[model samples]
Target chain A: MQIVREQDVVPFRNRVKEFATKIGMSLVNQTKLITAASELVRNMLKYANGGKILLEIISKNAQTGVRLTFIDEGPGITDIKQAMQDGFSTGKSLGLGLPGAKRLVNEFDLKSKPGEGTTVTVTHWKNGR
Target chain B: MDRIPILKMGQFLLVTIQVDLYDRLALNLENDLINMVSKTGARGVLIDISAVSIVDSFMGRILGNIASMSRIMDAETVVVGMQPAVAITLVELGLTLQGVYTALDVEKGMELLHDKIGTIEHPEDEEEEAPHDDID
Candidate 1:
């Protein structure tokens, strides 16, 4: 379990990188994971108030991959469906956080409520790893 | 036109540029990136492209340039918050960036900078002579 505090984002990144290294993710996949992880982590700070992230590596024989989970406790998203749509961001930057993170990996799932916060999970196969 | 100019934020370097769909500006962005990377001697970069809505093939090429530039500079670059709609449109237009580093927002991008740049302990760097003047 990796925890990201309100003001500390660098530790979270190093933690994620360390986590990826332990999982034996290839350089390519590691970069992808890093990119995806940062995106999710950034969203926690920007949209949500703050949150913690959990990264778990899963392997089965010839197949190896990573599972990322982000849980944020904030005001929660008002529109998850619309948020998933391309070009839909509540901030000034181009609205590609969720969707771009989704494309980096093989599997992605996100859940959020208006007042319940947001939880996101993503997985990338070793082939895609 | 003059240089697009590079803006530095302590450890984070930024270059705010506008380019046509042609490959010219995109290539220029690449060259400017090299100069900025040399000058700042920082570990990472945050490219905030919130103003750009249209991403052409030339724009797509910028990612590859960033990736290569980072490697040579012993630094890393992370593009933050590019428009997702532009992403889709670029891909649909048969454009792709094979190797690139990207983040969702500035916060996370900072995190990456820390991870990559944190190893430097500058106890002697201030006293040492820099090798290049190309950075300025």
Candidate 2:
């Protein structure tokens, strides 16, 4: 688990980029993964005081991919379905945080409780599957 | 006080960001660009971001804000030299940078600025017989 802080954003992105590159992911796919990672990491810092992220390189049936899971024990999302909608941001942002990140990755999973916390998992396959 | 330098070129202001900008540095750039536009009466502002490799929502907002603020001050802002990866990332992040002009490179951005705001007439183009007063 990696700590998520404002200062950690750039270094995190760089590390993710390096990992994606090492896995032979295309430039476009690498960029997408890094971008999604950036959004989720920032959300951790914004919602929770701070959080931790777990990065793993996974493979399934000879297909390789990168997976990132963000966990925070802050005030969790009340209505996840609504929160997943674009232009639906609790923060005074452009409201594209959740939905935008979902679209950029191959797979997305989010679980949250009103008072417990939020866990976001996203994965991007090397071949864009 | 780490700040990007803003140079005056004729009727335009040029800024090149060669480093990764955190929140404070980005905010300082926005403030400096606006003030320079006001103080110099610059008609166009060109920002070169070819060297910048990473940008987040905050940085994206700063770019948009600088464009809007320059517009309010009667100056046009053109963002130039965005990498392909950065473009895709911004689009995925839902930042289209609406109302802000963009170019592939500095030369094209300069041309675009000249189109929006006419070029500043050079004193060398004036006749020798005219007043010998120095404008610089």
Candidate 3:
């Protein structure tokens, strides 16, 4: 697990990019995955101070994909439904944070509590439509 | 203290980000670019991001802010040499960068800016007469 912070954004994206390239992912696909990762990591830093991410390569039914789980132990989200809305943001931004990241990948799972923490898991499948 | 240099061409300011842009650096660039646009009365601006590999929402917002700020200053902004991957990522992120213009390269970006603002009166025809070896 790699710690996610402000300075770690670029390096985290680079590591994800390398893994995507190694999996024979196209440049476009690689960018999408890395971009998604960038958003999640930044969220971890912004809302949770800093967190750790688990990177994994998974296979099922002769298919391969990359999975990332972001775990943060800060003040958790109160309303997951409203937070996933396209234009809702607690920070000074366009509020495309969670939804935008979700749009860039194949699978997304977000679990959070009021005071516990937040864990967001996302995946990108190779040649996934 | 790292600062990205903004070059003043005939009537346009050129900024080529050759290194990874950190949060502070990006914010600083925004402030500098806006100030430069106002002080120089530049009609157009071209930002080359060919060397940049990754762009997240923060970087996307910075670009958008720079373009918007330049527009308010009566200066047009053109982003040049965006990698195909970055472009794709941006689209997925739902950041169309609505007001900013984009080009395949600096030369084309310059030309686009010229088309938008038209040619201004200058003492010398440095644009056409100057050597074009720097555009790679």
RMSD (Å) of each candidate, 1 decimal: 16.3, 7.3, 7.0
CA-lDDT, candidates in order:
0.67, 0.86, 0.88
In candidate 1, list every pair of residues with a backbone clash. A126-A129, B39-B135
Q: Judged by DockQ, which candidate is best?
A: 3
Provide the clash count, candidate 3.
0
Candidate 1 runs further than 4 Å off: A1-7, A60-62, B1-136
**What value does DockQ give for candidate 1?**
0.02
Q: How accurate is candidate 1 locally (lDDT)?
A: 0.67
lDDT of 1 at B103: 69
Give the worst 10-residue stretch by lDDT in candidate 1 chain B.
B16-25
| Chain B TM-score, one value per candidate, order as shown | 0.71, 0.86, 0.86
Lowest-lDDT window of 10 residues in candidate 3 chain A?
A1-10
Error of 3 at B18 (Å): 1.9
- Model 1's CAPRI class is incorrect
> Each model's DockQ?
0.02, 0.43, 0.65
Q: Between 1 and 2, whose TM-score is larger?
A: 2
Interface RMSD of 2: 2.0
TM-score of 2: 0.87
Best by TM-score: 3
